[model samples]
Target: MGNTVIEKIIQAHTADEVAPGRIVWMDLDIRSARDFGGPNVVKNYEREYAGLPLADKSKTYFTFDLCAPACTLKYADNQQACRDFARRNGVEVYDVDSGVGTHVLMEGGLARANGTVVGTDSHMNILGAIGAFGQGMGDVDVTFAFRTGRTWFEVPESVRVVLKGTFKKPTSAKDLTLYLLKVLGTKKIALRSAEFTGPAVAGLSLAGRLTLCSMVTEMAGIIGFIPECGAEARKEIESYTKTPYSPFSPDGDAGYAETIEVDVQGLSPQVAAPPSPTNVKPAVELRGTKIDSGFIGSCTNGRFEDFAEAARLLIGRKVKKGIMLKIVPATRRVYKELLARGILQDLFEAGAIVVNPGCGGCAEGHVGLTGKGEVQISTGNRNFAGKQGKGQTYLASPAVVAASCILGHIAGPEDL
Candidate 1:
């Protein structure tokens, strides 16, 4: 039988049996832990091998993006523990100033196309944007990988997802993602691998693909792969690999558990209401829903394009008097680019607050949170109750969040 994207990567990484439902030990190209569960991983590793050397210390990493700069005393101590452990073990830590761990891996080319990576971040599968096999595992699983540089994984069922529309003005990749969330929901995609195909994936930029694959976890799926990389993305990938970039493609007759089709034509801006990411509806339907706060950054949608698009809406307009808008860049690189373009100045003049680059506010440990009984329209993924704050958080695209900041209510940029 033919192989899918996930199957091809599995074959490349392992010498064991390869088939759906088969569990085997595969080599990992990169292993990492974030500030959130990094302390636990350290504890586990020491208990197992106190005086032993790591299997591949050079390939291991720790990212301090979650609650970076130590939001609480416990977090501060935890981060310090990781730093000390990394020092003793000779592993590297990406420090508080570094951006999200997922972004760090790809930007550094540590997780390359057609490779395997495992990390503590649930959204580590975001690496699928570059055609890598990535998974999120518990601290114990990571500890073993730290010791041996390999982990057990079940070859998941592959699902073919055909997207059938092109994006128009004011309608974005996030909307395309939400539209899929509404159509595919959880049951259809849960526990399976989805390979995005069709017109939408043909000309998608790296940023847009990142946004599209970042949310696979919300719907309970395995990695979301966009196997086709644009020329610019290939150049960036090859820059770190120091070689030509050759991508993986599924076989023409690849075996799939199912084939699902999603049509984004005539789709309006979509927003996931409170309590569930799959609980989505059109943005216009929720118009005039009052909001007290706004946020425009997350690993999913915190690229330079996201910020620049928001700046386009805020250039000549000031944020509403009673509302607070927070802008955070995902990486120091993106933050520097924003400064070079004076995007921060435009946002500042519009009464918006620009914070340092990192995974800001999405974890509820940093800024951009809402209070009791308040309402917020955010660009971050997942609006589960109390995830962002006690107040309700409605998930939308960057354009919608920027427009809402100006009107102090749920709004879109198209009619602005």
Candidate 2:
């Protein structure tokens, strides 16, 4: 049988035949660690490698995203450790304000089609949006990758998901992804790679594809790839790369462990209820659920397009009295673009708190952490308790977050 997209990439990187379940050491194009576990990686590297030089310092990097700006002393020290290591080794550091590492890597062109990148961030697989192979591992593994310029991976069995029909107005890629979570469930995709194709995905925008792949981690997937990533994504990849970058595609006769289809004809805005990303349902069904705060940012939905959707509802409207709405762009580039478009001023006038570009509201101690007993609707993935704070986090699209911010409850765009 012909190979899947991951298999083909692996073969090229390793120069060896690959199959599902096989383990191979693939040369890495980029290696990184974010602030959260980055210190551990530095410690491991120093302890294990001692005075040995890295295989290639140019490919090494440190991204400060999670808890960026050093919310606490411990985090501050951790970030400093990573910076010190990068300074001594001549490794690049996408510092505190740079944004989410995954987005930063993509924006900088280090993560491109058919390339392999490994990092400490669990959401690194979000790079698959552009057809790259990105994986997240523990600090020890990352240290090894830093020193050797390679990492071993177990080829995952691949699944073919065929999406039929188009999204109606008001529904978005975030909604479609939540619908997938509701139908496919984590059990179905756990440890397996999924290749998305079909009419529904053909004309999807680059931001939409990024939204879809960013949530694969929530689906318990190894990676979720949207191959044939259109001209927009290709242009972005080509603009950053020194060499020609062709997105990887599966062979026509590629063997899939499972094949499934999703009809998105009537899909609507969706939400993952408090405490779990998998507990997804139509947002309409949960309308009126009271929310203390609303957050419109994260690697998943913190791009310019995501905020633009929210701006449509907030430009002339005010956040409900007593409700706190937080707006955070994914990267400094996204933040600057919004400023240039006047979206930033409009958001501020709407009574929203627009913070620096980074992973806001996505984890504990981040920009929008909820207080005890509070209920929040956010664009970030993962609602697991204690991750976003002691209070509950409900995941939804930027449109939903905007509407809910104005209405004081969980709501859909139509509610406005």
Candidate 3:
């Protein structure tokens, strides 16, 4: 059988023919951990390696993005330990105000296309947008990558997702991803790799591709793959995929465990209701559902394009009375760029509470926490019960969240 993109990538790393279900040790190009997993990874590395030095400090990265600025003393201590370890080991660390770990890695050009990257955060799969093989693992696995230069994996079967049509305006990559989750149902793709193909894939920007891949974690996917586009239209993306690193594409006759087609031309904005990312519904169906707050940022949909789209709808408008709106950039560079463009000023004038770039509010007990009996619409990836506090959370695109903030209800940009 012909090899899928993932299988080809694995073969390139192993220098041997590989197939799904086979275990192989692959050299890692990047190994990363964020605050939540950093300290544990460091502790485990010390305990296991003892006097042995890390395989290569330049290949590892540490970031303080979760609970950044330290929501509690314990969090602060954990971050300090991570900083100390990074300094001692000479590993690069992105501290507070730097940005989400994935964003930092992508924006800094540290994550190379066709490379293998493993991280302590599940959403590390987002790096697949650049044609890299990225997967999430436990702290112990991260420590193993630190101690040695390689990690092992069982090649995963591929799911072929063919995108046929362009998304309608206000119906973004986020909406399309939610629709996929709703169709496939969470866990159906677990331990499998998703290969995005078809005509529409050629038109998706890197930011859009990043948003699409980010939520594959919700489906328990090992990685999301977007093959190199051969057209001149893809020149920008080619910069990261061409030359020294072997660019990967599935063989024409590649075997796939399943094949699904998505026609985005008719797709509408989608929302995942409380307690599950798969509990998705068309945004219009939930219109007029009152919301106490809304958030317009997360690693999934916090790129500059997301903010620009949201600002287009939110400018000259004010958040509804008694309803709170929170805006967070995914990275410090994105934040500064938005500030230079007055996007932050527009959001601030709209009565939005602009917070630092981090994963703070996505989890409960941090900034933007909701209260009992409240409801919120957010752009965050998950909406599980109590994820953001003692309230119901709905997941939507940035445009949908921004519109809901203005209307005080679940709404789409069309409502404005």
Candidate 4:
């Protein structure tokens, strides 16, 4: 029987003939936890498992994203639990580096080359950067991965997002995703998989793929995958994979419950109207809308490449007089790399504030939050009302966010 790569992987882990839309229990090949939520997951593990050793901890994975340093307090307290648990059962915990987000870390090795992965955090979809069927689950399910190395999934019907045409303007994958959220409301595809195909996606960088899949959760989808394409994809595959790395694509006859095509030609930068990621409009439509704050950071677009993009635009310029711009790296490693590259100095001299990593201004809970009547442009994942501060939050790509900050208003790279 022919099945999609994702379906085949899931079926290999199960004894049944898996089909789309069927709920079935299967073993998890890998599981990861981050500092943001790892401590609590460990606490739950301690409470539920009670001295029971994991069936095979070797398959269990733990990573110390440690970006939210403050949140590590819980991890500190629970380290013994995690360490002892891992030692007792043979789990591998990554503590040496913090290059990217958890989702990025999970895909570091063969984990990305076509496998079924489950994580404790929502952005687990980023594993799709290398063509993996990955999803986020509750701590309970993660705990099960530690014990029995398995979890359950109701195989999702796929939704194909066919990207056509090359980008005519400076629009980014971030803009494409914002437009997507507008097309597919937040709650419409709660447990579906988003499959990106067509020529547009075929040319995108691996970073672009990560950005697209990372935000799939905002649209309420459980999984996102892009069939492998280009040397960019091959480079990522060779980085962590010892096994043979083969690219995957949907069968020509593979089924999709819905399909949407986005044309990138002449696409303008888009912003999510206040209060919702799905509430979006073209940036040009928001001309003359002054913003008090601008942020460029978060796992979605806080990589070194994102920093380089912003620095390229802000090197000789200053943020507008009335505007306050904040730059956050996704992790300390990214922060240090930017510092080494002198991008840090360029950003600060350009009148932007540099802050510690972690969700940053993305979710609006901390770091450079907005005040009443304040308007901000950011590269964070969502712009839902009060998402960053009670003030207005418009989503844009890193370049757009940096350029808009210098202009004190909504603008794109071209406007710079």
The sequence of per-residue lDDT tens digits that candidate 3 reaches over residues 1-416 is 79888888788788544788989988888899988888899889888887789999998999778887887888889889999888888988899878788878867767767778888888888988877888888999999998897888899999998877766677888898898899878766788999988656666776778888999989888889878553442554555445443458788899999998866677899999988999999999999999999887778888878888888888889999999888888889889989999999988988989888886477642465778898988888887787777889899999999999999899888888
Q: lDDT by residue for model 1 over 35-103, one digit each (tens)? A: 888999999988988999899999999988888778899899999999999999999999999888898
Off by over 4 Å in 4: 64-67, 71-100, 103-107, 187-190, 240-244, 362-368
Instruction: Please identify model 2 stretches exceeding 4 Å from their true place.
Output: 242-245
The whole-model lDDT of each prediction reads 0.88, 0.88, 0.83, 0.72
What's each prediction's clash count? 0, 0, 0, 5
lDDT of 2 by residue, 173-272 (tens): 9999989988888888789899998766766677788889988898899999987566665665676665676777899999899999889887888999
For candidate 4, which ten residues in a row score worst on lDDT? 66-75
The TM-score of candidate 2 is 0.97
Q: Which residue pairs in model 2 clash with each other?
A: none
Prediction 3 global C-alpha lDDT: 0.83
TM-score for each prediction? Answer: 0.97, 0.97, 0.94, 0.88
Off by over 4 Å in 1: 235-242
Between 3 and 4, whose lDDT is larger?
A: 3
Task: Tell me how far the alpha carbon of residue 316 in candidate 3 is from the true structure, in angstroms, after superposition.
Answer: 1.1
